[model samples]
Target: MDKHHSKYQITQLSAGEEYSIELYPKDEVVKAKYIGQGKLEGFGNQHLFISEGKDKNYIAMNDYWLRKKDDGILTYAPISSFSTLRINKSGLGEMLDSENVHYKNLGLRIIRFLESFGEKFD
Candidate 1:
């Protein structure tokens, strides 16, 4: 794990590997598969994509930024700021970061999903 964010660690995903992800707050968990890393457009940054049926979402390997708000809420800026996040090899993750209410709620949902799989976050 990165020293600055010892609580978070990222396990690289393999192509075609299937996993579960919590994409929305209070929503049912969805099945997802690693699609691979690449850029959608010539000028875009390289990123990894996961497919949940017909829906595809990108996970930015780098440039995933986050911070804590004054009210102790977590906030994140996907491609703009800094923080640490890791999804373990067993498909578990811990994120101590996000501020916008929507993103904060979404983060909590993800944490709950990971907890369901036996992962815990501080």
Candidate 2:
């Protein structure tokens, strides 16, 4: 098993409810999607991200190759500015590398996780 394979619990925050942030093995192909309303909402092929870690190379990366199916694909709005953001009352620790697109991959995973909750609510 991968070192990061342990199951995690999502914490609730002012921004949104935290859901488990678990990473699947590269062999697994998890479907990603946006949380929408009504019949218009459902799961769809999407991307996911993996944090490269901090230090010399300050940027997370997408473990899998993600390609848009078509112009019809859905793109969720960017969440936090940083790939690994932990918002607390003390202050915000956000590291947004505007020149880097790896952060966007993190967004996709968040969106997918959110959609899972939406299904339960509905």
Best by lDDT: 1
Top-TM-score structure, candidate number: 1
Question: How far does residue 89 in candidate 2 sit from its true spot (Å)?
Answer: 17
lDDT of 1 at 7: 34
Span of 10 residues, lowest total lDDT, candidate 1: 77-86
Task: Please state every model's RMSD to the true fold in angstroms.
Answer: 15.7, 15.8
Q: lDDT by residue for model 2 over 33-56, one digit each (tens)?
A: 222221112223222222222321
lDDT at residue 63 of model 2 (Cα atoms): 18
Error of 1 at 23 (Å): 2.4
Q: What is residue 52's positional error in candidate 1, in angstroms?
A: 4.3
**Clashes in predicted model 1:** 7
Question: Per-model C-alpha lDDT, please?
Answer: 0.39, 0.25
| TM accuracy, model 1 | 0.33
Estimate the TM-score of every prediction. Answer: 0.33, 0.20
By summed lDDT, the worst window of 10 consecutive residues in model 2 runs over 55-64
